[model samples]
Target: MRLDASAGGPSGAGLPARLVWLCVALAAGVAAIALGTATWALAQSPGPAPTTVGLALVCAAVASIAITAGAAACVHRLARAHVRTKASASAGQPVAGQQVEVYVGLARRLQGLVHREIQLLDVLEAQVEDPDLLKGLFQVDHLATRIRRYAENLAVVGGAVPRRQWSRPLPLVEVLRSAIAEVEQYARVRVVPPVEGTVRGHAGADVVHLLAELVENATAFAPPHTEVTVRARRVALGVAVEVDDRGLGMPHPEQDRVNALLADPGRVDVGDLLRDGRIGAWVVSALARRHGITVKLQSNVYGGLQAVVILPTPLLGDRPPARPPATEPGRMPSRGEPTGTATASSSMAGASPSPVGARHHPPAPPALTRAASPATAPAFRDAVASGQAPRDAGAAGPLLPRRTRQAHLAAPLTRGGPGPVNQPAGDHDPTLMADFLRGASSGSGEPPAVRAVPRH
Candidate 1:
């Protein structure tokens, strides 16, 4: 089989520029040499000989420089190709971008999975009272949160959005603490000065995420024993959050490059972070540029890096009150907990009576183990009082086997023939009538009592 290949990129464009430079250099050197040789041959005395020799030497130097440059470029290209081959061999694939896509796709899905697990774990955590169980749940929840952050890192590198946002403005202090809580080295982070401001709801989530990235970077590069600290203070224009660590600081040139990227991330797509391996700086820069936030890095007094994020006036708001709306009644809102508003099935849920259509439909006749006759109305009172499933004669428990009595068809009525089977003609007690009426009025799924025909 034969393969077709089309040259592009440097092969089609950049290769010509290098060749043109080489040709120009060679032409200059050759012209100089030719001119020098002619000058020397035509020289009538030693006075011009010296000038001719100098010109020839200059030509030789030019040729040497051009040749060396071309040779260096060839060696560099070979070295780069060798490195790529080695990498391809080690990784067992030529398509690294495909691997990145797969990894990021899985990471995003894993993020959702971890979030759901954390939510379930949160619900379970609230229900369990044992200290040990609560501790275990907290640990699991923490791990899930870490996994969520890792996934966010992958998402940011993949040029995707982060997965957190506050529906309302959060206090600056709270945002800082929340960001700190997300880092793996949370224990080492200490917040100071108790800032007073609110991160605008629109920017709260991204700000928190940005801060978390900076904080994580700080802690990761720091020694285990050293502490990373965060400080936030209200400023005239907005909020300034500083994250500092005691780790070895970044070099000045690197710091300047990072700052430049943060200041002007115009065309710098964060997706390049996959190849760049600078996830933290790229994430910080991308978020900062997007949110109108500014990030500046400086060497700390303790020989560490300090990242300062400036939240502009628009992204700042008045601090939220200590008691949020949900907590005004003395409790935090449960996640997605239903509000106090009335619902279609509210009657079933509370003291109010359910309308006929809104009530739970009564069990079908065949499913009924009991008579399901008018007498069934009274059983609801017992069911309600005892909080147990109502029972009647021949009524079996939900799981038990019971014979389904086939309903008999009533014969046509006639004076000589037996009349249709009649229900027992017991005297209607007013109290039973009242109880039955009460149960039915209460929408207790009570069937109405059958009426009897008076004897003529």
Candidate 2:
């Protein structure tokens, strides 16, 4: 990549200039040798030859000194260029016609470090509340170790340090929770699965980089009192981690911009957002890609933004085969069904009503076509009148059994063939209605004693 001269400056040009100077020195040395040899030849036939030879030697020394001085000047220039480059790269850019800014870059780097440190401390605090502080301490130590490792990696990239490997399994969830908790102190944020659990695979520094950026962005954009939730779920292909915030939702245009930035993983420039003093969303995108994960931003359920990172699953060598999906007590319903309902029709058939008011709508009748027996009619009528359907029915299927009972109840109220009576409207006691529907017959089998229906 050709770094812009104005951006990184002439730091890279130093080596070439030094090589040119070396060539000059070599040429000077050769010329001095030739001149000295000629002078020695001339002095051999004359008086005071040794003195002439000394003069030639002095000339050679002078040439050598001149070459050394030239080389020294080149070296000085190279050092200055190196310094300029370092200063330029670190200082970044200033607004048009303004003096180059140094504090901004330094402040950003410092802020990043401080934020990471605070996150580590929060994780440690979370661990302390546990009865087994040793485990907590281990987690804290692991996270701290990973952060240090990442810092070392950054230093190596900056040419200021060496590379190292993390031999022990790093506690990623601990570190991630810490990062989230640290941000939550000043920002409204919630970390899902706040407790410790192991995720498969070794993620290295990339996980930390992506999560930190995500949490930081969530904290920045979310409004006060708005919660930012970070959750991770293990999937068939991999683990999917989501950071959701309830704030001003990202507009479609901005979402598109974010997508474009993620498409090209190489670009680290946060662009205008950073330039305008806001942390660029691109930072999260770049880090996610580095870890072999795909990042996507979308509207969250609460009408805010969500940052999702899908990481590839790791293979466990020599491990036992994965177990089949076990049937849990509450099997979640299929996509089209209401949330949290069981999917199996048999389970729904025996399912009892929740405590009175707590009950959800009862399941619909089963698809059987048999006529309702006399014994079941009254029971069915009461269930329907109370807005409860039979359990044998499909939860979402037609209420055939209930409808049949309603027909029976309407028969008593209706004289002609079978239909609802056109009775006048009046405030009737609900209990009376229930009692009447419950088949409590007046001594005579006629309709129970009741007030005359009011005329419309």
For lDDT, the strongest prediction is 1
The clash count for each model shown is 0, 3
Candidate 2 lDDT score relative to the true structure: 0.39
| lDDT for each residue of candidate 2 in 1-456, tens digit (9 for 90 to 100) | 000010111223435644644553463544345344534444355432344434443453454334433432332333233334444666894322111122222223423442344344444344334344334333333333333333332322222312222322233355466455433232366666622222222444446555655665676677767777888654433457788878777888777666666666334344343333322243344344545567777888888788887754331111111211112224211111111222242133212211111011112222222122222233344434533343213222343443222222242242232222221111011233423432234212334234123223
For model 1, give the 10-residue run with minimal summed lDDT: 1-10
For each candidate in turn, the TM-score is 0.45, 0.37
How accurate locally is residue 63 in candidate 1, as Cα lDDT from 0 to 100?
A: 42
Best by TM-score: 1
lDDT of 1 by residue, 6-78 (tens): 1111212235534633453453345335334534433544332344434543453454334323322322222
Clashing pairs in 2: 364-393, 365-393, 366-393
